[model samples]
Structure formats: C-alpha cells, structure tokens
Target chain A: MPYRFLEDVAIADVAFEAEGRTLPEVFEASALALTEVMVDLDGLSPVLSREITLTAEDLETLLFRWLAELIYLKDSACLLFCRFQIAIREGTEWELQATVWGEGIDYGKLPLKLDVKAVTYHLFVIEQIPAGWRARVVLDI
Target chain B: MEAKKIAEGIWEVPRTAKEGMLVPARIYATDKLFKEMDQGVFEQVTNVACLPGIQKYAICMPDGHWGYGFPIGGVAAMDTKTGVISPGGIGFDINCGMRLIRTNLIEAEVKPKLRDLIDRLFHAVPCGVGTKGFLKLKEDEFREIMVQGAQGIIRRGYGWPEDAERMEDAGRIPGADPAKVSPKATSRGIHQLGTLGSGNHYLEIQVVYPGNVYDADAAKAMGIDRDFQVVVMFHCGSRGFGHQVGTDYLDLFGPAMKRYGITIRDRELACAPFASPEGQDYFKAMVCAANSAFANRQMVTHRIREVFSDVFKRDARDLGLDIVYDVTHNIAKIERYQVNGEEKELLVHRKGATRSFPPGHPELAERYRATGQPVIIGGSMETGSYLLIGTAKAMEESFGSTCHGSGRTMSRTAAKKKVHGRDLLQRMEQKGIYVRAASFAGVAEEAGMAYKDISDVVEAVETLGISKKVVRLQPIGNIKG
Candidate 1:
C-alpha cells in the first residue's frame, strides 16, 4: 500500500499519508486512500470512466483540487472510482489530468463507509523527499 | 502555553500566552474534562485569539477538541467593524444541526414496532455515501429552497405550517442570495436534500425516561410531558453544498487575506475582513448553505413523518409528530451584543457549539419566551443526549453559546482499530439499543468510548449557568448513515 491512515491526526475526521517515487504515483496513492475511506475498492467495478483535468498554482493546491474533484463527483454524479491513471505536468503551473474508472454507486450492492465531505488544508502537505514524493491530507468526513 | 484555572469549570489563557494575541482565551470545562483536551485545542483557540478584532475571549466549550484551525467547540465573537470572517471557524458543514421531534406515544406502545419503524425509515430516508435524495428539484426550485429554507419546503407540503416557527431563525435566515452560491455547489447539493450523510450523522428514536426529566416545566413546555414519551432526533448538515461553499470561500479567503494585508499563524484560519467585499460575499454564500441545511432537515422531517404514517397506520399529526426544536450548532451570525457597556453588533462564529439564547431575548419565537431556547446536545449512539435551556449568564459571558455534543476524544482510526463493528453491534443490542448502520466499519469508528462522557460535558455547561439541564433522552433505535 502506498498510503497509510494516520492514527492520531484527526479525532473526528480521517487523515492519511501517501508516498510514491513520482508525482503521478503519489496523486494516485492519495486518491486511492481517499476513496478507500468512503468505500472498499474491491467492491467497485470499472464499468464507468470519467476524465478530469484541473490546474492549480502549486503542487499542494493541485493535490487538494484533485481530491476535491473526486469528492465533488461523488456527490454530483453518484460516482465512485476504484482505479486511477493520473498524469501530473508542471510547467508554468501544475496541471493534472486523470481518467478514473468506476461505476455508479449502488447502495444495495456497495458497502459505503464514511462520506468524504471536503479536503482540508489543515496540516495539508505535498512535497518531494530525497527518495520520493510524500503527501499528507486531512479529509473532513 | 499555560492555562490557569480562573473559576470553577473555567480556565483562562492570558493574552501573553501566545504571540500576536489581541485578547485572552477562555475554556469552559471541568478539571477532568480539561485534562482530556489535546494540545491542539489550546493551540488553535489561542491562535484564534490573535485574529484581528477579536473581543473579550476566544472560548472553547466543554466538548472542545482539536479541529482544523479552530477547536471543534470553538466560539469567537469579533468586532464587526474590524473583525474578519473565517470559513474555518464555521466548519465545512454549514448549519450542521440537531432536530428533535415530539410524539405522543409512550415507550411501551413503540417498543413492539421499533424495528419495523427504523427499517422503514432506513429505506425511506436515504443514508450513507453517494446516496441521492428522494426529492428531484429543478435548478430554480433548488435556488428557491436555498433562499426560503424550511418555509419553501413546507409550502411544497413537506412539513406542517407551524414547523418553521419551532426552528432557530424560523429555519430561514434573512438575506440569503442564491446568486452568491456557485454552480458547482448547487449541483453537488441539488440531489442531497433529505439525505443523512455518514460520519456521526444519525436518525434515532429516543425516549425520555421518567427520572431523566430534570426540569419538569421546561420539559413539558418542549412537549415532553409523559414519563416515557418518545421523540425523534437527527443530526446532519448542508451536505456537499455546504462543503463546496466553505471550500470555495477558503480558496478565495486565502488570497483575499493578502489583499487585506492580513497574516495568520495558520493557513486554515484564512479570513477576510467582515466588511470587505470578500467577507460579505462569503457571508451571503454561507447563509445560502445554512438555509439549504435547514431545508435539508425539513425534507428529512417530512420523510420521517411519511414513514411513521405508514408503519403506525395513522396520520403524522395524529401521532403528535411535531417539532420540539431545530437548532444549528455550526454557523456565523452578525448579532447585537453589549460589549464594553455599549450595544454593538458582533460577528459571532460558533463551530460545533450551539447558540444558547436566553429567555426574553427578542430573537426567540414567542412560544419560547418563558422557557428560553431549547438546546439539543447530541451524544454518541451508545450514550444519552441532553436537552438544556439557555440562560442569561450565557448571554453575558459566552455570547449565547454552549457545548454541541460529547466531542470525540479518540481518532476515528484508533476507534475502528479498537472496536470491531460486529462486536459493537452485539454489545449495543445487549444494552437495548437497536442500530441499523450503512457500514459496520463506520459503526466501529463511532464507538461510544471514542467520545467524552455526555454527562460530563452537560455538567460543565450546567454548572457554569450557560444552560440549564432540562432532560436527557436515551436512544432506543438508531439509523446510522
């Protein structure tokens, strides 16, 4: 697993830390951690796909926006994803493009856990370490 | 870094406790409760005291715990002329509140049909993640509900005509401009009405035991007359709509602070001057989310009524399904308060703290003038919740506020690690609580041991004279989202 849940970070909300050797890997790891907080990934089937493209001023904001986009889609379209193919390109600004595959949420078939409300900037971190990229996020559930 | 015990159930951290602090910080808790508070509560509350235009004190209730930028039970009253409005202070769930509905039936009559009733409610009122509401509204109608709140839904035949009066602000605050809300927020929340979102959100059937009623007159005034009278209480908020509103403003306020030349210790405490354009825009938008929350609870109330009508084979009204009170614990409002012997308007931000307006206050509805506003403090499903009444002391000291709940003392991950969902289910059943949860993992995460004792939090507020204990309601059946 690329991401692990933090035991004592947020008392009422879910907090996790993710790591990867590349920006895309880290983003994918963080995305999976967030989705895992809501529902089991194994229970989801890749019958539907949605493409998202977002740009932010920095890597941290880009990660925040990416997670927020996943939450927004969950509410707006009743969609949840189990797989992510992410690409992060940093030019003048940080841009993220991803194609996430999942299916429409069926309450009867899926085991839904916590509802990830919003991604908070509290203790939010995204940076490149000497070995790889690491990101920490606290999600409002 | 030091907090001195100022009085019984009260602790104060001087302005010298932290740099850039303009006012002192006060925490309302017993010595026991205070000891359990994490270091984050002190750090965040002190950080709030340093914000520009803060007045008197930055107060944390007995249920206070570490939150994003502000403590969960944080309350800060700011000078309206110079103070700033921060989205972090109000929380992501705008107007996340509690609604308590009364019923004439007693426990004996309801015991046999409890499981059937709860199951029906579970099916009727959609819960859990990615659950859409039953009501499908056009974009315009959604906007109307944003502005009109419970009144709009009541007009649409979702509630009784008098239901609005039983709510704080009559379930609709004035000056909510739908135009201030973004399309993203609207789309995200348009289908979320009547939904009970997960994570500590629940719809429970509670009974007021004979010995639990502390103030008989107050309890009766709030419609708990019988010894074992039944009531329904649910905790939820504006859903994704409120989160989007908070998120949108947090993004804007972060940069807006730069234009205002404001610097803060924490980025999560991002704010803009209350009178500034950015602040006013957020305020109006926040009101829209607040009203949407009111409307959300209204639709949930209607669904509960429908389920009750079907299961019991009687009209909802005939079952005495009337609202006892609806109170929102999370919000920021510009209210007039006496500061320094002068009555001036202040922007009071209450995050995870209920507004405990005393009796005779002009804001309260006529029915509650004698008994004061009814304050509902929801507890963990395993523990009992409380009903308290506002007091004059709260108005004079804490800016009309009190604790919101038995705040969490343990992290969700730790809780899930300690309590297995299946075991907790069996344990709760043995304790006479029948729970239907959408996710067993969620149940483990919300185990009773993870939170502070409801009685302790209630005692602190009661001892401080902020609110008087009226009654305690025990949950008999619960539907967890």
Candidate 2:
C-alpha cells in the first residue's frame, strides 16, 4: 500500500523485498515512506536543499536513527523531504547520504497537524512482503 | 488488556505474570471500562510492577495509557522503609491538575453573560507555551512562591482566601524546601505563576446539570442545584517551575539511584531510596512543584473572578468564584493507608490518579468532611467534564485513588494525521461551545477524538464504587493552553 494516514497514526505500504535487492534499496524505501508523513512530495518543490549523512552500527539501526533524526528535523525546522538518491559505504559502521527539503513554516496558518512528542518503544516491523516492508507507528503527540 | 477481578471490585496482577517485576499490580475498574485496555497498556503497566521498593502493587485506575515510564493511569505506593521514588512515576509535568472555582450566583443571572465573561478570561489569562502570566516575580520572589505555594500568591492578594482552604493539602504540600530547587527551576517559574500551560490544560465554563440523584433538596445542599446551572472549571498545573524540578531531579536521581543500589527496569524508572538524601531532596522539590501548581491555578481563579465581575457588571464581591478543590496529577507524597488492616506510612505515588479520600478521612478539610474530597476530572475542551466525590471503597481498594480524566486513546500524531485542524474547529464550534487556542497545532493535537470516552472512564470507577458521581458539567466555553 502507498503511504497514507491511518486513524491518527502515519502508515506506509512499500516494497522492502523486491525479489532480491541490496540493503540500500530497502533502506531508501523506508525513508521515502517516512518523509511522506511530513509533507506532500508531489506538492513539495524541493526549492530548498541540504545533505544529511550518518554513520551507525548496521542497516536497521541506521535506518531507525535516520527516521528519528528526520522526524526531529520536521519538528525543529518544520522542513520535510522528497525524492532520494542513496548509496551505502560499509566499514566499522554504515554510512548514509541524502537530500532533505521543504518550505518555511507559516505560523499564520496551522499546517502541522500533530506534535510527535517522542518516538516510542512500541515501534516494530510486522514482516517483509513481496513488495516491501509495512510498519505501524503510534507517535506521542 | 482487560482487568480480571482478583476480588469483588478489586483486581490483582499475579506475581508470576511478567518478568523483572518486583511486586504485583492491582487495578480498580468496572467490568465495562476494564475492557478498554489494549494489550500494550497491560504490558507496560506490568512492567512498572517490576520496579524496586514498589511496596504493595503497581496499580492503575480505569484510565491507563502507554507512557514514558509508569503508565499514565498508574499508581504505586513504595514503602518508605525500603521504597524508591521515581521521576517516571511522577511524569515530566509535575502536578498537572484541575481546579474548580464556584460562585454565589445561580444559573439565571450568569448563563446569559457567559460568553462575554469567557472572552474576558481568554484575553486576561495567559495560556499556551511561552505565554507570560499576570503576576511577575523576581528570583527571590519566585523562591517565596515555591515555599508558600498558593498561600504565597493569595497572601499577595491574587486570589481569594478560600482558595487555599479548599485545595488539596491546603494549596501547598508540606516539606517543600525551596532551597533544594535549582536556579534554572526558579528562573523558569518566575513568570509562569497563574498561567495555563498547554496540553489538555483548559479553563472551561459549565452549567451544573442535575447530580442525577433523587434527593432534590439534598442535591442543593451539595451544590448540585438544578438544570442549566452555570459554573466554571479549569485544569492546569505547575508550569516551568514544576517541569524544571522534575528535570533537575531526574538528572539528580538518575545517578543517585545507582549509588543507592536501585535497579530500574528502564532508565526512565530511575529511583532513590525514600530514606536516602536523594529521596528526601526529590520529595522536598516535588512539594515545591505541587505548591507552584496550586498557586498557578489560584491565580487563574483570581482572573476568573475579575472577568466574571466585569462581564456581569457587578462588584467582584457579588460574583462568587469559590474554590471547589484542586488536586495534583504528577507528584509523589507520603501518606498512610491500611495494609492488611494495619496502618502503614508509605510514599503513595499518584502519577495520574486523584486522591479520592472519602468523607471520613481526617486529611480532608473541615467543609468537605460532609461531602468528601471533590474529584474534578476535566475532559477535552470540547466534550465535557465531571465532578465526583470520593468513596471509602477507593481508599480501601486502590490506594485511596481514582481516575484523573479521559486518558489519551490516540496519540496527537495519529489524531492530527486523521483530522484536519481547520475541520476540527468547525465541528467544535457547531457543538455550541466556542474555543480560543494558542496555535492550530495545539487545537488539532488536543481534538476530542484524541481521548477516550470520559463517561466510560467515570462509569468504571463509579460502578466499582470507588468514586460516585456528584455532578456532570457540560462545557459552555474554554480557553486552551
């Protein structure tokens, strides 16, 4: 299923396992779904630009931390992202590079719907489907 | 997720249920409300059961939730002789609570002027994050407010004298040593007294509906009166002062607990032995937070009277805004309760539970002895709220406590993801009550759907005979933080 809002939680349908793919593709799909929660990719012009790179233990922790930091940016900067080109460098830890962009927050209008107070321990992966990975998150607003 | 009856109207969490548990857990809820618990909530609550110095049981009222450390609806009493006090048990926002201010006027004269009165309150009262309050105090003055609690403010004449008398612990918790508080905590508190901080905190205008009791004459004596009866209800807490205390203490206790040999199941559950210096310090600081909260609400009461006087075109004396009661949500205190029919002096930590002391309890104020401690549970700004009195069953069954409010059912993120802020505003307006908020995100995050049915939560406690309904108040207007 494509990324969409469910109840009050944000959910996504993506192909984590596309018949045999590298770890990078799966990681990229998760980021795509996460950014979808903050801003509308189709409408986001990417007029602004920046780079976020992280080195972490392995694939899963790296993705989790990336999503968390991404959320932090959404909260602190009010900027969302779209369209990612990714590559992974493996050494002691995994390395990540990506571009994140969005427009300035208009305080006059309340565009931000929820206040994600914190990412909770309730996060978990159900399983990998033929298309990709499907996950559910209940943020503390 | 559902509650299993360990006894009649008393539920128990068997010791063998979960790992890392130091003690069992207990719950008090009606069969209907018991069913609302999801599996995750049960697990989290049981996790709290495993903490050190957790004397009797990790307990919860009907309104439980998945939260940082202890479940939002959790209640635990640790033995002072060998117990621990955890910040997670008290939560980040210390003493977040509700206060009720009553008036001398009946429904007829004030109901017509309610809107104008609310507008005045909305403008006069400071709300939302970073919103400054009416009274400004310096660092030393803030320290005084910390020690005296609401009395410090009332002595300065911000609110009525009756406010301190009617509130829990007389508008201040004893043993609050302001000296234990940090400079940062004092700085944060200087400007926040009497301010309504955000997140479910609100000042609501209400009319007293029938107590739904048969004795009409008796109801009047109890302040229930009749239909269309008007009143005002607000919920708030110690602002930056309380937040800072919790933050500072959590930092203080994080390492102190290890020194005291306290092993927590989670980092957030760090605790110190009750007899230890760290424990004593946290208690003293917590009292300061509780007092600050009492003063914060008292200041709002002062503003309410001022607004009502202006709107009604009458002298302030003519418009009575009496203090019903004010109770804390996130604080730990030392109290005595019966364990196996023997009195035990224990530190009863009520994170989200209200102290529902029955009429006979000696801790109650003189005036409330006949009616018991009034339990003010404020629902969402849009739906409504409730006024209840304590039952002896609550004291004997669940550490002399009951549910606080409608616990959050869905996260703000999920709620925001589902409902548009603009649309939510329209829906609330159509309901006949007007809401003025600080930010659009504030309103969306606090939408009524974010919480469970308060009526259900109340019904659980009532059916179990822990708390009895005294009156049901529907909102007329509200000022959100």
| Tens-digit lDDT track of model 1 for B170-233 | 9999989899899999999999899999999999999999899999999999999998999999
lDDT (Cα, 0-100) at B58 in candidate 1: 98
CA lDDT of each prediction against the hidden true structure: 0.93, 0.69
- Work out the TM-score per prediction: 0.99, 0.79
Q: What's the CA error at residue B433 for candidate 2, in Å?
A: 1.2
All candidates: CA RMSD (Å): 0.9, 6.6
Worst 10 residues of 1 chain B by lDDT: B247-256
For model 2, the superposed segments whose C-alpha errors exceed 4 Å read A1-141, B1-3, B8-10, B105-112, B211-222
Q: Would candidate 1 be rated incorrect, acceptable, medium or high by CAPRI criteria?
A: high
Every candidate's DockQ is: 0.84, 0.10
Best by DockQ: 1
